[model samples]
Structures are given as C-alpha cells and as structure tokens.
Target: MSLNKETIRVMNVNIYCEYNISEKPPLILIHGYLSSTYTFHRIMSKLSENYSVIAIDLPGFGRSEKSKSFRYSFENYAQLIKEVMDYFHITRVTLVGHSMGGQVSLNVAKFYPEKVSKLILLNSSGYLKRANQLLILSSYLPFFHRYVHYHINKHDVKEELKKVLFNHSLITDEMMEEYKRPLLEKDFPHSLIRLLRHREGDLSSQDLNQIYTPALLIWGKQDEVVPFKVGQKLASELPNANLIAYDQAGHLITEEKPVEVVEQILKFA
Candidate 1:
C-alpha cells in the first residue's frame, strides 16, 4: 500500500507525516528519540490494512523541521499530536508509540483521554529522570551543540543498529541511510541541544496510575536500552495493561518483530 506523505504546519512548525486512510479509528505511530516515520515503515502497511495508519516525524527529528524555538516537552508533543488529529478531522485514535514516543502517548492519554481509544507501547522508556545536571548545565554553553553533534556523528550506524537489534543481520544499507539522514541537516545539532535541555522526566507512578485507558505493553527481553523489567513494572502500575515479551527482539521491537507486533496489535487494539 502506498502512503500519502505530507507536511502540515502546526504551532509554527512543519510536521512531516506518512498516512493511509481507512474507516476505523486511526492508528497514530510515534517514533522514539532521534527516530522518524522511517522507524515504522516495516509495520505501517500491514497495520493500514486494518486501521488508518498515520506515522509522523516529531519536530527536530526525521523530515520534520528542526526549530530551535519549538518546545520539546512531552506535554507539548501530546498537544501537537492532538492538533494533528484535528487537522485530519480525526476524533479518536489508537496511539502506537515506541520508546520516547510511548511516554508521549501516555501524556496524551493522561491529559486528553477522549482523543485516545487505546495505547500501545514498544520497549517504552519509563521511570527515567531528566538529563544529568552536568549535561543539562553544559547545554547552557554556547558551543555545546557542536559537541553534541560531533559525539553522535562520530558513531558508526551499523554499530548503533547492532546495539538496538538482537539480530545483527537486520541491519542494512537502507536502514543506515535513513537513520543518518537527519544528522546531515545543518540545524539538527542546535535543535537537539534544545531538546536535551527542554525534555522532562518520564511520568511518575501516580501519573501512570491515573491513566485508565486500556494499554498494551510490548517488550523485547533482550532490550538493553529499556529492559524488560521496565515493562513488567509498567504492567503492574497501569490499571488496564498487559505485557508481551519477545525473547529474540531488542530495543527496536517494531522493526525486529513486525509480524508479532502486528498480530498483538490486531488482538489487543
């Protein structure tokens, strides 16, 4: 299935997205930190078969504009998502968020419950504090953004993918190219510095408890970034949540196990 790619202006920012229409409530796919709609390419087609699928590149990531002035907090991100839904005339949706996106989805459900019918999180980041004082403090320095850019740009894409995927064979030329695209943008480094300074910590247990929306938490047992233990803790905290763990997967569960992820989504959402 071919997706319609478009860039919509919201809150003075150009938000990039790929979508396919369907009668069912839309499935909003939100990628993790430093990721984009490309992260969901593997599962979007199959998911579109059952529900309208909309995958977006959050501000400062992917094809989206890297605005130094845009607020990067999870609360603002949730609000931006709601505005996107309104732009498409969508009332309610099933939110499918991976990693950092998962935390954003939770904020949406917490603050705008009426807009979300279901929540699906894959290897979601949880119970984490904001950046360390030293990093946050250093972001105040004039040239810190350059240092941030240099640090990330120096890493080999293949090595980075290996750390996220349990199966190294899945790393490919296309994946590397897509992952590296944003780094080449001139404004990316500055935007990333703002994101690092503006991002808030994940919601606390009390906040998680208040979100009663039915949720499905999917975790990769081998995930090194956000381990399976986090999923177990989330399932226990969330009022209506169930977790499913995949032994062979890792941080990139959506890419590593698209079929299984789709199957579970069809079953739960």
Candidate 2:
C-alpha cells in the first residue's frame, strides 16, 4: 500500500499521521506510550487493503508535535482524534489501540460513540490509577524534566525493547533506532513530565460499562506490562466484548503476531 504522510494542525497542535486510501470505513491505529505509528507498521499495509488505515502519532510521541502547552490527558487526546476524523471527512472508524493508545481509544468510544463503529484493544492499559502523589508533587519542581530525561537516558534501548516484546529475536537495529528516535528531541522530556502531571487515571468499570460499542480485546498471555488478567477483567466489564489470548505473545502483540491481529480485526470489525 502507498502510505501518505501528513501533518495537520488540530486544536492548535500539529499532529502527524500516515494514511492509505480505501473505500471502506477507516481504521485508526493508536500506539502506546513512548511509541508512534511505527508500532503498527507490520499490519498497516495489509489492513489498508480492506480499510483506509490512518495511523497517528499522538502529541508528545512519534512525529507529532511535542508541545509543552498541550494537555496530555486522555480526554484531550480523544478530542484531537475527533478533529482528525473531521479533517479527513471520516464519519466512523474502527479504533485499534495498543497499551496507552487503547486507553485513549476507550475514551473516544466512551465520549464519541457516534464516530466509532468498533473498538479493538491490544493488551490495553486498563483500570490503573494515576501517578503516585510523590511523583505528582515532584513534577512541580523546576528541573524535574531534566531528571526525567536522565532516568530514561540511562536505559539501553535494546533492553527496554526486551521488556515489551516476548520474542527478543525480533529485536533489530532498526527497531532500536525507531524506539530511540523521540528520545533525541530536546522537548520530549518536558512533554513527558507534562503528560505525567496532566494524565488522569484510567477509565473506571463504571465508565467502561457506559460504552456499549462492540469491542474486541486481544491479550498477550505472556505480557508483563499489562497482564493477560487485565484483558479478562476488561472482557467481563465491557458489556459487549470478546477476549482472545496469544500465549506466546507479550505486550507488543502487534509486532509479535501481526498476522493474527489482522485476522482478528478483519473478523471482528
């Protein structure tokens, strides 16, 4: 598929996105924290064959603007997504979100049900509380962003990738390069601090129940980041949902099992 890349101004922030033309309802792919549209590269081409796939880099991550002024909460992110749909003249979409992106997708489905046709979450972060009080308090410190940069700078990209992927063999130089790309930006750390301070806790069970949209929850049984049990809980709480587990997969199920992920998305959406 020929992917078209563009940067559109939404809500005063320049948002970066990649899309392929198709006649079917669009598929909006949202990546996890510290990730970009690259996370969905494996499935983008194939998925675009059936649906117009629009993969985005949420503010503060990927190629999108890392504005210090942008509200880094899920609600704001959901609103930005809605504006994106309007920009593209898309009426409805199948939201495919992974990890933090999944939480953002949940927010969209919960608040803008009319704009969503289906919801698919991959090892999505759910029912988690916000940052600890101590961390929130420290965020007020003038130089806290530098500390955040220091902490993240200390970790090797390859090791970090290992923590998210069950199949370490998939780790390649290209993967490390893409994962580390955002870290090179001087403004990224500041935006991350703003995110930690502004991000609210995940949606509660009451909130999830309100969303009656058809949902599919795909979990990586070996996922240590967001355990498979979370998926089980989500399935139980989401009024209309189905849960599928891949025993050999980890948090980065999109990378580990893209073929199966596409199959499930096609069957469900």
Candidate 3:
C-alpha cells in the first residue's frame, strides 16, 4: 500500500504523520523502538474521524532520514518532536507513545509539561532501565552490530523482534512484513544502532513528583518488554498518573487492543 497521504511538514524533517487535518483535539501517535508510525495505521484510521491523529515516524525511523552522525538519544528525539509541534503551531496536545516512543513522550511531558495537555504511555520503557542495561551493554560490544548486519540478509532477527513484541499471536504475517520492510532499506540498521546507543533512560523518574499533567499509563498483562507490575510503580510515582492493565494483551497493547486503548485515551483526552 502506498503511504502517500501520510506526509506532513514538521520542522526540518518532512515526517510521516497521518491525520484528518479537519478534526479537533489533535493527538500525536509515537511508535516504539525499531518500529515506525505504520504501527498506528489501523488505530489512526479509526480515530481520524473524530480527532486529528498525527502519528510520526521519528527522525531516524521510517520515511524521515537524518544525516550521518545524528545522535538518537531520548532527549534529542524529544527535541525533534517539540520542534515538529512548534512548527505546526500546536499549543496543547495529547501525546501517546509506545515503548521507546513512550520514553520519549514522557520526557516531553516532563520537560515541556506546559505544551502537553495529557500524557499517554503504552507499555513505556522508562519504568525499568536496569533491566535494559544488558541490551545497552551488548549494543556497545565491539562488532556486535556486525552480527545485526550479517543477520539482516540471513533473515534471522525475527526471534529478537518477537521478543520485543512479547511473542504475541496477534502479530500477523502482514504486520511482520510491515515491521521488517524498513530494515530492508540500506542504512536503517546503523540508524537503529545510533538510537539504541544514544537513548537516555527515563527522565520522568529523576523528578517524578514534578509532573502535574494528568497522565494515563496503559500496559498489557502479558507484556514481556515492560512488565505490567512496573506500571503500578509508575502510577504511584508520577504525580497524577493512572494505570489501566489489559488482560491477555502483550507489549503492543494499542496494536493488539486498539478499541480498548482508544476508549481509554478518549476518556483521558
């Protein structure tokens, strides 16, 4: 399928954000790590009718290409997003992020609380960083990325990808194709490495008591990436946050349970 209509001029990055521009209460959708705005395709279609759904493929992912040596830390990602929002003249908007995207969204909320009207994190990563330290250390290993390069052609990374998605049965063949298509393009893996290495851990935890923006935390009962129990700690820490756990779901809660997610977001938004 051609993704022609999903184009949007945001900052210097001509990002891929899909939405019905006429709708009210603009909402921005952010995808997880190693993923793209395509993750929200189905959700956006259903939401665009009543709300302006803007799903962006972050600077290093999907359609937006960054120059060589661009650092992909959570702070930089948050800044890029802020620039995009500013370019569009968005004052107060609802921010929804999944996994790594959730980390970025929370940082945006903490740093630019005035700009974000509400924060929605779907199985976010900030709640647990020590657990991800092993991946961070491995990404820094000498020639570790070479394995990723060699495996890309061998088509052996599906298992790792499955781990990220929590081995969900809802991951259809078509969805797998969509997830893997971007990696087929040259230079995608290098960008992925850059993002993984530079990402700063959860900024929300530094001063969790400061966040006054009404926040909603959603997680899957079976989420392997960020366990459901972590959401309880986050809810307890974030000043005004609430948690909603979806039974029988995995890491990709919004993707796996779009209706429930949309309903909760609408209630909070």
Candidate 4:
C-alpha cells in the first residue's frame, strides 16, 4: 500500500512525513543534507507493500520549517528525531539514512540504541580520515559558496546539484526542481548555514566500535563526497555490519539505482 503524506507541527516546526503501516517492522528513512522526505519516494512506495515505512523531512529541509534560532547539530537533529518517534509512539525502528542522514542515524544509535532496531548508512559522511579534513573546509568558504550557488541558479539548478551527487547523470531536471523549490524559500539559506556550521564528523574510533547495532553500509564506488574507502572504514568499525559498493553509481546512490538499493534494503530487513 502507498503511504499518504502528512504533516505535523512540533515546536513550531512543520515536519512533513509519510507513514504507511503494514504487518512487518516499521522502517524510518532519513534523507541526507539539504534533502527532503521526497528522496525516498520510490523506495517507500516499494517497501510499503510489505513493511511499514515512515520517511520524514528533517528540520530546515523540504516541508519542515527551519528554526533559525536553534543550533543545527547532528546531535540535536537526532534528539528531534527521537521526539518524532515518541510522538508517534514508535518504540523500535530500523533507521536507513543516506549521506548526512546516515551520520544522524549513527548519532541516534549511539545515544538511543534502544530505539533503533537496525542502522543502514548509504554513502554516509563521518568516517573521513584526518587528511581529508582540509579539503572539506575549503568548500565552506563564502567565495566558493557564491560560485556554487550562482551556477545552481544559472543552469536550472541541476548543474550545481550534480556536484554533490555521486551519480551526476541521475540528477534530472525533475529531481533538481524537487530539491530546489523548497530551498528557494526565505529561511532555507540560514538553515543551511547553521547546518554547515554545526556539522562535526569527528566520531572517535572507540565510539565507532561501540555501536553494536546490526548495520548495513552502502557506498558508490565513484562517490566524490564520501570516498568508497570511508565506507570500508565504517564497515570495519561497525560490528555485524556488511558493506556493498556500487561501481557505476556516485554519491546519490538512492537516486541513481533505486531498484538495487531497495532490493538490498529488503534483503537486509
């Protein structure tokens, strides 16, 4: 069965989410940085046939209202997600996060392991080595930001969108529009700024080994944002974790190969 989308207001933030209940265990799909619940549209529809699926737009993205005053750290986002789960009376869930969302899932698994049944990280950030820190910082500057944003405006947004995507070709005009339309809203930029400022990917090796959750990690072999080696690192650290690498895809594995991604998720579930 297909899930009907819904929205709920919590702490003055509008959270856009879709909930579909079936007999099987519920799945919570979390999108990556600057992404909305729409990222999981295809997967949700397919998985809902047997398993319940709940996909939400994190605060400051998609239909979720950005709280400019709040600090947008991954830890805070995980707390907000915990609150959302409590609001729905959902005790146990399998969290499947893509990119930034994967990082958030790791935070949740760390802080509230009781609530998470399983963890899935797809092209996730947070396992970067010491050497890559400098390169990531360079992209945070205003000059580069303006250059990137300018190109996004000049080329139907898809041109700039492709940069963050692992599989650039899958970033179609339609996908670009879906991702861009909400970003044009007045508060989006500030929210994005807060997200960047608060992003910290310094998870300790000790902590990584502590996550005993059944985890599945997927990475695009050509992922430019989080290298394939990072996935290998994550798989090594996480106990009972399996890693899958997609050779032809980029960072946006969900968009590039939705069918295979969903199939892998089902097998893991």
Clashing pairs in 1: none
True-vs-predicted CA distance for residue 90, candidate 3, Å: 1.1
Ranking by TM-score: 2, 1, 4, 3
Show model 2 residue runs off by greater than 4 Å: none
C-alpha local distance difference test of each model? 0.93, 0.93, 0.75, 0.80
The TM-score obtained by model 4 is 0.86
TM-score of each: 0.98, 0.98, 0.85, 0.86
lDDT tens digits by residue: candidate 1, 1-269: 88999999998899999999878768999999889998899999998888899999999999999998899998899999999899889999999999999999999999899999999999999999988989889899888888988988999988998999999999889999999989989899988888888889999999999999999999999999999999999999999999999998999998899999999999988
**What lDDT score goes with residue 249 in model 3?**
81
Error of 1 at 198 (Å): 1.0
Sorted on lDDT, highest at the top, how do the candidates line up? 2, 1, 4, 3
Q: What tens-digit string does per-residue lDDT give for candidate 2 at 1-269?
A: 78999998999998999998568878999999999999999999999889988999999999999998999999999998899899888989889999999999999998899999999999999999999989999989998888999988999999999999999999999999999999989999988998998899999999999999999999899999999999999999999999999988999999999999999999998
lDDT per residue as tens, model 3, 1-269: 22235655554555766555553887888998778887777677767766776778887677767434667877777787787777667777889898888878887887788889998989987654433667778887888767766766576445655665644566677777777777776677677677667866576464677888888999988888888877788788888999999887888786678899888887888
RMSD after Cα superposition, model 2: 0.8
Error at 102, model 3, angstroms: 1.0
Query: Model 2 lDDT vs. the true structure?
Result: 0.93
RMSD of each predicted structure: 0.9, 0.8, 3.4, 3.8
